[model samples]
Target: MNRLKPFYEITVKLAELLDQDINAKNRETIISQVNLLIEKRGDLLPEVPPPFTEDEKRVGSDIVLLNNKIQQKMNALFIDLKREMKQFKKQKKSNKTYTNPYEKIQTMDGMFLDNKK
Candidate 1:
C-alpha cells in the first residue's frame, strides 16, 4: 500500500462524511468520525518531496481538492451551528420571560428615597 493511498482515502472518507445531513442522530456520529479521520490523517500524513511519479502527483492533487472541499463544508457547518445556538438561546430567553414576565424588571427594593423641599 502506497503511503499516499491511505492519506488520500482518509481525505475521501472525510469529505463523504462531511457531506451527510446533520441531524440529532447523525451529528454525534459525524463528529466522531471526523475526529477519527483527522487523527488518522495526522498520523498517516505523507511527505512526497522533489520528483513525483504521475500517479503520486494525481493523488496529491486529488487530496488537495478534497481538503479544500472539507474545509468549506466544515466552515459552513460551523456557521449553521452558530446560528442554531443563537436561536436556541433566544428561545430559552423567550420561555423564561413568558414564565415570569417581571423576572428581569429593575426593582428599587433596598433603596431609600429622600424628598427635600
Candidate 2:
C-alpha cells in the first residue's frame, strides 16, 4: 500500500501538467481529490504492486523509460512554447509542426532496447 503512494502521486503530477487551460479543473482536480482521499483513508492502497514476469518487466521498464522521456520532452516543450509564446503572444498555425506526435518517441524507445543488452 505504501509503495502505491508514489505511483499515484506521479500519475497525479502527470495529469496536472497536461491541462492546457488555466481555468480547467479536470484531471488536476480529480487527481488531487484522489490524493487527498488516499491521505485520509490509508487502507485503500494495494498491499503490493503486482509481481512482474520477465516480459512484463521488459514492457514495464519500457513504459517507465518512455514516461521519463515524455516528462523530459514535455518540460522541454513547455520551455520552447514559453519562448515562442513570448515572441508571438498568440497561437498561430505554423507551417512546420509536429505532424507526428511520435517524432522523438524513437530516441527514448531505443534507450530501453540498448539498455537491455
Candidate 3:
C-alpha cells in the first residue's frame, strides 16, 4: 500500500469540499469540515517518510496538484468572505442611519448668531 494514499485522498476530498457552493445554511458545517481536514492533513504529513517508489511519486505529484487547486479555492473563498463582510458593514450602517437619521448630525457647533436690535 502507498503511504501517500491517505494524504492524496484527503487532499482530493478537501478540493471537492472547497469546490462546493457555500450559502448561509451549510456554511458553518462546511467550514468546520474544511478545518478538520486541514488539521488531519497536517497530522498525516510527518508520518510519510522518504525513499519514494514510482507509484508513490506519482501520488505525491497528484497531491501537489490538488494542493494548488485547494490553495486557489481557499483564496477565492477569502476574497468572497471579505466582500460579504464589507457589504454587511455597509448594510448595518445604512440600517442605523435609517433608524435614526439625526444620529450623525452635528448641531450648534460653537457658532453664535448676532442680531441687531
Candidate 4:
C-alpha cells in the first residue's frame, strides 16, 4: 500500500487538474507536474498504482454515465431546435400567403362582367 500512496495522490491531483477547466498556462503546469512525478517515480511506475478492490471494479467509473447524460442533452437540444424551426417555417408560410378565390369573370361585349352576379 505504501507504494500505491504516490499514485493515489497523483490520481487525485490529475482528477483535480482535469475537473477545473483551464487555459494554456494552467494546462501546461499540470502536465509538467505529471511529467515530473513520472520522472521521480522512474521504473517503479507500474508498481505505484495498485489495482482497485472488487467493489471499485464492480462499480466502475461514472464517466460513461456522465457522457451519456451529455449526449442526451445534446440530442434533446437538437430535437427542440428542429421543432422550433419547423414551427417558424409554418408560421412564415401562414403569415404571408394569398388566398385568391376568383369566382368568375366574363369578357362579353368588349367589357368585363362579373358572372357571379
Top of the candidates by lDDT: 3
User: For candidate 3, lDDT tens digit of each residue in 1-117?
Assistant: 368888988999999999999876787798899999999999999999888888898888888998999999888877877898999999999999999999987768888766677
Question: By summed lDDT, which 10 consecutive residues of candidate 4 come out lowest?
Answer: 58-67
Off by over 4 Å in 3: 109-117
lDDT values of the candidates? 0.86, 0.51, 0.89, 0.52
Best TM-score among the predictions, by candidate number: 3
Q: On a 0 to 100 scale, what is the lDDT of residue 101 in model 4?
A: 33
Model 2 alpha-carbon drift over 4 Å, by segment: 1-49, 89-117
Work out the TM-score per prediction.
0.82, 0.32, 0.86, 0.35
RMSD for all candidates, in order, please: 3.5, 20.0, 3.8, 14.0
Model 2 Cα lDDT, one tens digit per residue, 1-117: 244445545544554444344322353564465456445434433443577566556555654664675466456656765786666643332312345555445465355554564
TM-score of 1: 0.82
In candidate 1 the C-alpha lDDT for residue 52 amounts to: 71
- How much lDDT does candidate 2 score? 0.51
What is the TM-score of candidate 2?
A: 0.32
Q: What's the residue-level lDDT of 71 in candidate 2?
A: 67
